[model samples]
Target: MFQKILIANRGEIALRVLRACKELGIQTVVVHSTADADAMHVRLADESVCIGPPPSRDSYLNIHQIVAACEITGADAVHPGYGFLSENAKFADILAAHNITFIGPSGDHIRVMGDKIEAKRTAKRLGIPVVPGSDGAVTEEKEARRIAAEIGYPVIIKASAGGGGRGMKVAHTETDLEIALQTARSEAGAAFGDDAVYIEKYLEKPRHIEVQVFGDGFGGGVHFGERDCSLQRRHQKVWEEANSPALNAEERSRIGGICAKAIADLGYSGAGTIEFLYENGEFYFIEMNTRLQVEHPVTEAITGIDLVHEQIRVASGGGLSVRQEDIKFNGHAIECRINAEDPRTFTPSPGTITHFHTPGGLGIRVDSGVYSGYKIPPYYDSLIGKLIVHGRNRVECMMRLRRALDEFVVDGIKTTLPLFRDLVGNADIANGDYDIHWLEKYLAKGE
Candidate 1:
């Protein structure tokens, strides 16, 4: 086990990592921007260092400042909690050069899987099914048109190096393809510094399902299970549930084997997620997330596994202590991403939280960073907290989540709680009969 580690991100995830360190008897140092100087994670950590200004580029995303903080704090490792530099391969390489363990996969694994095009090819070669489309990146409009004809109409163009719904365009016909291709290429170049874009068959209503896997660089890996992230807005997940009611035992085993083999082929280590798009009873590999996901708590709730501790143990040169056969998932767990935004307009509402109250009881977990009097910052993501609930089954889980969301209150700033409450109690979500476009249709009734 590491003697000490530095948390390189902020908000609830930073506090999440801090609690993990505490349980492992590891000392923790938290790095924060000036805006989060007095945040809860900073107060809970053994030591706190101000990295830079409020802007993420100079603070949370600044690799050098974070490494320097680790040096000053005498920490032996660094844990990036899900965002900013967590998936950056160069950051991992720098940590390696400094002899500091990056509590995730190796630099090579990240670099290989970080690029969407490369990951697709890798999955294809490993016999994992991928959505049929372009052979590789299309450098010109002519080539893109040719590929679109071969793959049929209604395809999606995406940045070879993109995530978070950026650098993506859907083309319903040949005319739309020309404009979408040019615009997508330009946007991809500006955002990722890579003009590379690839085409894939666009499923109109695919369910987002991902498997959580853990590996020890030593040829041993196991999947905790899958999370149904079908409840989304604009390609970003809002609510996630474990042991997807949509997947049967046979499907679960099939997907689990596929994920384990894909990463195991790359000699992957540490914690990661293999994301897939499921539609019409068929599954296709979409991409792989190289860091811990925001919805990981749902998996933990069902499996009773401490993923952070697994990462720490794996980093200390240990293999998976438990085998795949020993793992068992019980009950259904759901997580709602509570964001600082208006439910009606979906616009950010950053301000001081005047009155704050959260629910507490059986099977309710609240992972939050803000409290009474804390001001929400506008420069970063609008996420304020994560509300998780567990129950004996899907119906009970839905009921518990609805009850929990009703009790969650943030007085000053508007939150997405109302939207989540409406979602959880809806007949579709309650019965698990929703697709990716479900939320959009529910909102479209208003528009």
Candidate 2:
């Protein structure tokens, strides 16, 4: 049993996990950099420790510092919330060596799935359809060009170890393949310290679909349904919804079953999201996030499950509390990631939140890590809050979301509130008739 858990990351997600721990009667120790001293998670945690300076590498990503924090704080477990070292297998191993539970899956599962090329191969072996791409990392321009030709012109060069849309570039012609590969490799090396690059057929106008699957590490898995994350910008999701409008019940069951079976077969445990790109009625595997997603609130909204609580309990060897048959899908839900930025230009806006008032009422949830007087440091992600709403149907959910967004107010710093205010009024968004490219095109046209 975990006595005290040390949260190894900052931002809203740290607050998110802390809330779950509080409900479970578990103590928490929040580790933060100097810049996040005023973060909500730090304030609410049972104990707080400053690991290092403001930079992520010096603090959040520093394994030794994190372990030291846990050791000194008497935390029995470490919850690496979403980003930073959440999927880092080495970090998991480090925690294991320290005899501190890592509140996620096994280190091996993380290592295997964190490698994109190897993960794709694993997916294919398990009968999960992967995007047509290089069988492995392409090291030569000739090989990349040949793969591009075989895949028929439009191809994407991706860093095998990359994420967050970095280390990815598209080439529509053979002449552009070499540059795309080189740029991807360079960026990959700089970002992930691994220059391994791969080629994949560029899918145009596909919906970003993901299934939330939880495993018991004992040959059983359950799915909490799917989320449509098609509305994205530069690979980061902007808006998310549960029980995708593009998918009917039959389609949902088919894909959901495939994902559940795959996780069970792998003996995977804890919360994970299997992402895919859907086009023309077919789902192609993209990647799997071994930890809870930033958009997990939507899934929780529909499933009525506290995923963070589940993750902590599973790590503490409590096993699954609910089975697949016991799972029930509730009404629709949507989440809008409200960021501290210019609504139109997307420039970061960091400063004091002069005034703050979260929307309230039935069917609305806002996960925020900042308060009115809190000074949002410029050294981190701009996401200040997650505005989620649940309803009997998608229509009601959207209506509630719009009303909540209207009622929401954060003064002093610019926010993407205006962007979302306009987004909720778009017809395509209302009808769920947009693709991955739709948002960019819509933004480009200044809609």
Candidate 3:
């Protein structure tokens, strides 16, 4: 086991890693920006260091400062809790050069899978189904047009190196394709510095589903299960549920096995997620998240597995102690990302939290970095907390989620609580009949 792990991030995820280290009897050293001196993780860590100022580039994303912090703290391993530099291959390699474990996948895997085009090719070669489109990057407009024609109309142009819905443009016809292709290339260039784009068949209402997998570099691991993350806004997941209501036992086993095998075959270690787009009972590989996901709580709720603990173990040159067959995913678990944003306009709300109250009951978990009097810094994401609930089934989960949400109180600032409150009572969401596009359309309709 690692003697200590340095957490190079902030907010709830940093706190999440800190708690995991505590249970494992591993000391935690948290590096934070000046804006996060009052962060819960910083307060709870065994040792703390101020990396830089409020801006991410000077702080959480600064490599030299983070490595220097690790050296100063004498931390043997690093646990990058999503976002920031979690998927940066160069960061992993730098840690390796310093003889410090990254607590994630190999640098090679991170580099290859970080690129969407490379990831899709890897998935397809591994026998996973991918959306029909260009075989590789479509550098020319004529090439993109040809590929679109072959795949049929209504194709999506995506950045070869992109996530979070940036550098993506959907075109319904040939005329639209020309304009979308040019604009998408420009956006991709400006955002990723690699104007490389690929064409893919766009399913109008595909459900975003992802499978959580943990692995040892020794080609051993287990697939915890799948998460239904279709409830999203602007490609950011808001509500996520485990043991998707859309899949049966057979379907779950099939997808889970495929994801696990792929992870193991790639010699990947630690925790990661294989994301997919599902439509018409078919699953298309979208991309893979090389680090822990925001919705990981839902999976932990159902499986009772401490994923961060697994990452620490696997990264410490240990294999998975739990077998795949031993994982018993019980009940349905749901997580709502409580962000500090306007409920109506979805604008960021960064201000002092006058009062903070969390609801507690059976199967309710609240992971938050903020408390009363914590002023939310606007230099980063607006996610303030996560509210998770588990129940015997989806219906019961819904009920528990509603009750939990009702009880959740964050005063003196706006939040997306109202959106969730209304969503719980909606017939479509209640019945689990929503697709990826459902929530956006529903919200736009002012329902």
Listed per candidate, the RMSD to the true structure in angstroms reads 1.1, 1.1, 0.8
Clashing pairs in 1: none
Q: List the residue pairs that clash in candidate 2.
A: none
In order, how many clashes per candidate? 0, 0, 0
For each candidate, what TM-score against the reference? 0.98, 0.98, 0.99
Across 1-447, the per-residue lDDT of candidate 3 in tens digits comes to: 899899999999999999999998999999999999988888899999999999999999999999999999999999999999999999999999999999899899898889899999998887777889888899888998889999998999999988888899999999999899999999999998999999999998889899999888787767998999999988889899998878889989999999898887777788889999998889999998899999899988998988888888888988887899889989999999899999878999999999999999999999999999999999999999999999999889999999999999999899999999999999998888999998899989998
Off by over 4 Å in 1: none
Q: What is the TM-score ranking, best to worst?
A: 3, 1, 2
User: Mind giving the per-residue lDDT tens digits that candidate 1 earns over 1-447?
Assistant: 899999999999999999999999999999999999989999999999999999999999999999999999999999998989999999999999999999999988898788899989988987788998987898888888888889888999999998777889999999999899889988888998987999999998899999999888887778998999988888889889999979999999998988787667767899999889999889898898888999999999998888988888888888776788888999999999999999878899999999889998889999999999999999999999999999999888888888888899899999999898788767787789988888878888963
Q: Which candidate has the top score in TM-score?
A: 3
List model 2 lDDT by residue over 237-256, tens digit each: 99999989999999999999
